[model samples]
Target: MNSSVEKCHMFHESAVDLLTSIDFCESTLKTSIFFVAFNPIFWNIISRLEYYTHFLTKLTRNPRTGCYVLAVTIFSLGLVRNYFFEQALYKQGVTGVLQNEVAKVLGVALIIIGQVLVLTSMYQLGIIGTYCGDYFGILMKERVSAFPFNICENPMYRGSTLSFLGISLLQGKSAGLLITFFVHMVYEIALKFEEPFTMKIYRNPKKD
Candidate 1:
């Protein structure tokens, strides 16, 4: 009876430790996710502000050059966001049994599909179109209704969300799953601001 009690005590302690570790990991993951979600929103707001103010153009002395600089800045921020996201994944504990061989395969497939949509959209848009050049008066001749775009209104955002979900599933990280939902929420909010502004730009040629 004493031995059984001792064994039960040990198991309880182990479970407590496991829970503590998971809590720590989740805290770190939330911080990482905040940065990932914030970066795009920050840049989008700043870029739109720049467009309205012409501060970037004044600083650069050329609208095209200013747009290019903003594009580079946005791209760099994206890289940083990805780094934080990866770090969060690393910190997360793999507690789910569903992260088996099948999960890994599904994750890889999702990543591939997401990349295809992203790359194809980029190709269709070119560097300027991909990076909000339209806001800077570098507008596309017309809307692109190609493979990815036709399939989804916002392929880039959807693809990115899918990639995040895929990675979370691949690693079987609960923290990652939560982060993915946060990512989707942030993108949805951004689109609410973005789509209307973009449509306004196109509708009023005077803005361009």
Candidate 2:
């Protein structure tokens, strides 16, 4: 009877440790998501402001250059966000059946598909169209209805979120799933502003 009680105590302690680790990981994941969400919203607002103020345009002396600057800034922030996401995953404790080979394979497949969608979309859009060049009077001739875009309205955002999920699965991290959901939410909110503003730019076809 004493041996059984000791075993139960050990099991309870282990479970408590696991729960504590999960809580820590979740808090870190939330911070990473916050930065990831903030990046797009920050750039979108800044780009729109630049469109009206021309501060970036005057500094760069070319609208395209300013757009490129913004793109680079966004890209750098993205790298940082990803780094934090990976760190959060590393901090998380693996649980359940997600650590199996089948899950790993599925995660790899999802990553591959996500990469294909992202790369193809970028190739079709080019740097100008891929970034917020429309804000600088650089507009695409028409909307691109390619393979990925044909399937979904925002393939890039969708693909990115998928990639995040894939990475989470590969790591068997539940925190990753939460972060992925936040990523999707942030992209959806961004689109609410981005899509309409882009359409207005095309409709007007004049730079301020």
Report the number of the highest-TM-score candidate.
2
- Backbone clash pairs for candidate 1 read none
Worst lDDT 10-window in candidate 1:
17-26
> Candidate 1's error at 101, in angstroms?
2.3
Q: Write the per-residue lDDT of candidate 1 for residues 1-208, one digit (tens) a residue.
A: 9999999998887555434435453555767777777777887887787768877888989878888898898889888778877888787677544447997888888888888888888888888888888777778898899888998988988888889888877876656666788889999999899999888888884544
What does the lDDT read for residue 198 in candidate 2? Answer: 82
Candidate 2 lDDT at 53 equals 82
| TM-score of every model versus the real structure | 0.84, 0.85
Clashing pairs in 2: none
Per-residue alpha-carbon lDDT of candidate 2 for residues 12-74, written as tens digits (9 for 90 to 100): 875654445465435667779789788898889888988788788899999899889988988
Model 1 residue 56 CA deviation in Å: 1.3
